[model samples]
Target: MAAEAARQAFRGRFLHCLPEGGGGYRVEYLEDGVLVVEGARIAALAAAGAAELQGLDLASCIDLGGDLVVPGFVDTHVHAPQLDVMGSHGEQLLEWLERYTFPAEARFADEAFARVAMADFLDALLCQGTTSAMVYATSHHHATDALFAAAEARRLCLIAGKVLMDRNAPEALRDSAVGGIAESRELIERWHGRGRLAYAVTPRFSITSSPAQLAGAGQLLRDHPGVYLQTHLAENPQEVAAVRELFPEAAHYLDTYDAHGLCTERSVFAHCLHLEAAEIRRLAETGAAVAFCPSSNLFLGSGLFNWQAFAAAEVPVTIASDVGAGTDLSMLGTLVDAYKVCQLGGHALPPLEAFYAITLGNARALGLEARIGTLAPGSDADFLRLNPRDVPLLAGRVAACRDIAEEWFAYQILGDDRLVRETWVAGECRKRDGRLAVGN
Candidate 1:
């Protein structure tokens, strides 16, 4: 990759979704804006050709014409290895795991396969304008190591961990509780806090992990502060029932992880579709974040999540592809599914709110909003330059837009990876015109 200049500026139609005092997003769209980047941070933003950048070299300026520049999407949850079996269907959660998901993830035990998959995954992430993601890998430590190396090479802000599954999994895919914790510790030692890369202590879920391993995972968090804890939660009814059968002593599915001290601000629990009122209240009280996987839930025939109830309960929520089960990597696609999910729940998710959930909202869920999820001054220079008129349909839609609100809603309903004209990460342009940028 070509070295990024010490400082640079880009001129574009800028957009950032700041939180409103109530429950929605406050959208700021600048028809003509200059975004200044110094090192890896967003230095400043001013009107195009403003006095602030008067003496800067013109060679350092990236002009996006009429394209839209917004903060890069933050996918709070995705399975990096599961991208291989993304389109497979016809089974619910448990049956799906046995038939397709586990088999596909087991392939990551091969080092070469893991590297290739992670490389492609990161490329897919960048091409679609995802700059930061909290990802999951297979049980193999070396394979997880390979994923970290691929992400570090790309300078992507990634948080990932090796899956810890001790029982009820295929023998080839399982590891003992003691061994799994040891493997996770080794990985955390090597990769945690390295550049923009962070680590998550991932105990696959209660069905696959033993109590000993869960406690070990909790201890791992206490041992290492600021590291994250990620795992699946009440994604499906059968999964929740299995958790009940397994942990008969616990109060509910959420209690399985909460019993392990795994419910905190640093914890990310994916898919609480089966939660009751008490569980939602507990999530709000415990400060844990839920990764609402709308697409995956729809594909698996999991129950519709009550978005309004979660919001009313004040439980922190972020969006995810839950890829493989989710069927797509596009955050726009996730937003699309989210919109439909909310519609089914009789709650209308405005386009502005949907965009916020994927960008700043997700960042806030991870406690990283100050560093990312915005074009706010001093944040990372990670964002996407999108042509709202990239395709014929979008072009027509853009032409008909009465205002920015209409344009935003139309894009969420119609956009995909093709809408991403360029993806910029940490002051460097990584993808342009739906492909890797020249240097990348």
Candidate 2:
């Protein structure tokens, strides 16, 4: 059934975030809370039994027994077309594309196949507690449209773009400079700012897109302001070398994009693992966001992202699954990997900060924090019901928790899709039992 944007009330142990004095968050943990949802927006949040709610009708209330409701995860970097090629092993960046990635994407040329694949990908994302994402579709315009149409029907907050690769790639996946730019422009006109959807100007990366095509993409961004830019950079040593070989006139790998005005506040650079001090500072200075795919990085044997350096540079960073290459879809799993990634370097990821990274921080990175990130009033009602008691080890861990902070800490480290009891979007419960909670 399609979820109606109707008013409802939820009583649970709720977690929400507000900006603290600095860039950190002030977490509000309501032990016994009541959150009122009127249509797609959060109307009010208060402790249960508050007299202010006494006058409201209580029959519409839904009680989540001892489960925790937190904002849904926002994945800033994902490949909607590469769902079936995730675990193909033993190849670096360029070779992986030739061996596994490109071949899988070639199949998107069949529009029917694209539809089925995108539907399952969206379903997987919801089951994994990802309500909002910035995705990359294939080079086929119709294939990308299929992904957008799927997201539109579900009212998902998604930002996606068709891959623009004019030079390198198999004959089936390549589009000419003029043809690719025209297709992108048409897509932007058709889909940009449509409902909860936005369009990104995607150039697969320097390796696939020629200088002419990259320049064309930059022109598209200028022609339509606020359209996002998504692409890869410095993800692998060989990939970086390829970019240097391809764009020898540029000072660095980032300079390849900078020369064409692709670097902007709205741009999302995925897996910036081997960035230099100058690149880090430039990313901060330009207000461009970084999509940190720790799980994908580890799985591909790419270098570790220096999180502290990015943080110290005051750059905006968001966590993502980068799936098909990424091991799994769970944000908790991503956080667990992020924690391990940092721990290996003798650093710590505080659980509160980690939670904030997946939710509010990610929303902020996409410039959509005002719309989908928090349970704050007037924000969209997208969240997940986490049952810490659902898993055996998690149940025991929760039983020993000394406080709410400890409870969250245990959940972040131990939780995954198995811990997600339900997923809600726009005041409607959508997923349970690793599938749709409500059916048409």
Candidate 3:
């Protein structure tokens, strides 16, 4: 009886996504849902009045009545260290890196500062209802280690790696090609597959990493079978031109990385705003994914992403905050920018599709669809409870909504952190009533 009593459950209006034919998804909503959690995974998700709830301890279930429950957001491309630089005066991608990003990252050499910043960064993500993320730490190996430590302590399903840059960066932040790969290997040995954490071999992008470092990064991926590769690609026209000049022999920007064996099934490229048609086909062929960072792209004055073109090419596309460069950390807020970006390209993003991108779509891009993205049985119980009526204006607008789709669109356009009433991670309450429940 005691063991059975220990199981956790929640009753609410649940929403999630299910794959349909033709690589599209359909929304599934249970108006009066009962989500039963055992240990760290969901045991059952059914109607409140379903037979599955007959003998369960509903008396102690967390009743989130009148609120919307959905899977927590998964951010595919964000810089954990760039939290300090977010909302700074926006500059072009290259100048922004030199002006704001590099200087801020230089501070991470001190492990103490890195620990504190990483703690705050993770807490901020939870506050914004982000549960899982692929993060980039500074080149300081100890700082990267601190990020992994903080994430492990919180039991987050996080994927991160230290930046690898041997040239084209500030002197203090650069690491030798040999040294960078060795440190990444050590970090991988120490942290990969530990609890819910994974490692990504992150080369800061072709502009920053030399040929040797990029090749070494690819080698690390081969050596560590399940490890991931994350980096930027074709974000700005200037950056693209520079890559062309630097890699004269390569076919294109994507070819530079592909030549080094960096394009793989687990690789995730961010801000592919200027990818050629050939590059798009190659991304699909290699099973690589793209992180459509709309907020960052718009903020940096980068060209608009052709969302329709990517979809037509069958390339896996996921939404990301891309903070510092990206203006907001809330995936809902990010979707607002994404909607506008798509609109600029003559295709509006549907509300359900926007929600799916931040949740299951992002998860599938990271190869984590079976775990953190859904409320399906046996998946990790990482989810959010959102209150559309958190503010007076939002309440008024949401009240006029005709259906769940309209309400969701209203939330996406008008919502911020306040919409997130609670953020639960692996069945543990991390944020309650829009505040951090755990000590920082």
Candidate 4:
């Protein structure tokens, strides 16, 4: 890597997604481009030999030979405290949570353990080329604070909040309705809009949080505008049935959250695999986003996500790695699973569309498109240098590709963390040569 400087440039093949008319996206690719970074923002992006490159410090530019430079991935939903339990024996959603999720989250009550776990979690995310994510922390306020502090130290764009679960969970992992709301309020005041950190009022789910707790979470969102709301929705049939039994008066599972003013533009619901038509329309009406966590859904035997329905409704959708329940942390691997899930539902996912969903689409869902998720000038300088030929199988497959889209598809199908050569966050190299370069 070149020496760090206030003004620096990197030359590579660059690609980014642009929103098209009619709620679609188009890919913009530059064969030989120079990305100029000044401070923490992108100053300029131009062809290597274009006149715009004149007067620039071309001699100091670091050239990434034949590598692909694209915006870093933005994971819409992930759990920071579940790193230790990833790939645990797959069971249904409720059973898995009780068996594996709760115990793993219980350890976060220890501040020291939480700090170390949060560090490892962030390192894992950076290694997988994820620069921005909406993360879920355990119910412990101190642990949530530790996560925010670590992310602030690294200057990462991370959104997280303490879990709010007043019932249907072990005592060690539950918080009272009033207490949870108070802690969340404090976290939002301290972390929201603090540098690159933000807070999300997280309710574990309808099954875990009492009615009062859910209402309190909504009040928290009302009290603090721009803070995010994240929770589980209709992921499993059993879970859906449970929600129906829990809230008999509500029209549907989504209605429970909606009644409490939790269905705002900033809210993100994960694993909405079994939503009804009315629910879909309501999501569209409220501008709430859904996180399509394919890996977790598949691993937990949850129903398939109705991508076609959501797309038709024009409700925002973003891909996510719901880690722990999810099989891996790499978004590339997650995309592989996403493609398979879509295919299983007879809707094929295009390569460019998959890439777009992880980058600009996700940022747009989170309402952070202006700050991150693109190579557009003035956006944060967060990106990845990916080498499709990182492994022999991937290299051979890419070598036979006739176009950029084919090459990208091959990478998604065969690539993993090894494909990421470098990850840059805020113009600083956090991972280089497939290893973490920054201290966690």
CA lDDT scores, all candidates in order: 0.87, 0.87, 0.91, 0.90
Provide the lDDT at 252 for model 1. Answer: 88
TM-score of each: 0.96, 0.96, 0.97, 0.97
Q: RMSD for each model, in Å, please?
A: 2.0, 1.7, 1.9, 1.5
How do the residues 95-165 of candidate 2 rate in per-residue lDDT, one tens digit apiece? 88899999999998898998888888898889989999999999999999999999887778999999999
Please list all clashing residue pairs in model 4, or write none if there are none.
none
| Model 1 lDDT tens row, 17-115 | 766565455667788888888888898876765724576554557778788889999998898888768888599999999999899988987888888
Q: Which window of ten consecutive residues has the lowest lDDT sum in model 1?
A: 51-60
For model 3, the run of ten residues with the poorest summed lDDT: 1-10
Tell me the spans in candidate 4 whose CA falls farther than 4 Å from its real position: 1-3, 20-24, 51-53
Colliding residue pairs in candidate 1: none
Per model, how many backbone clashes are there?
0, 4, 0, 0
Candidate 4 per-residue lDDT over residues 1-440, each given as its tens digit: 33574788898899998766666667889988899998888998888888244876666688889799999999989999998888787579889989999999999888899999998899899999999999999999999998998898777999999999999999999899999999999999998999998889999899999899999999998888989999999999999999999999999999999999999999999999888889999999999999999999899889788899899899999999999889889999999999999999899999988988999999989989888889989999999999977777999998899988898899888999999999999988999998888885
**Of candidates 3 and 2, the better by TM-score:** 3
Clash pairs (backbone) in predicted model 2? 1-439, 1-440, 86-324, 430-437
Q: Candidate 4 at residue 227, lDDT?
A: 94
Q: TM-score ranking from best to worst?
A: 4, 3, 2, 1
Off by over 4 Å in 1: 1-4, 19-25, 49-60, 438-440
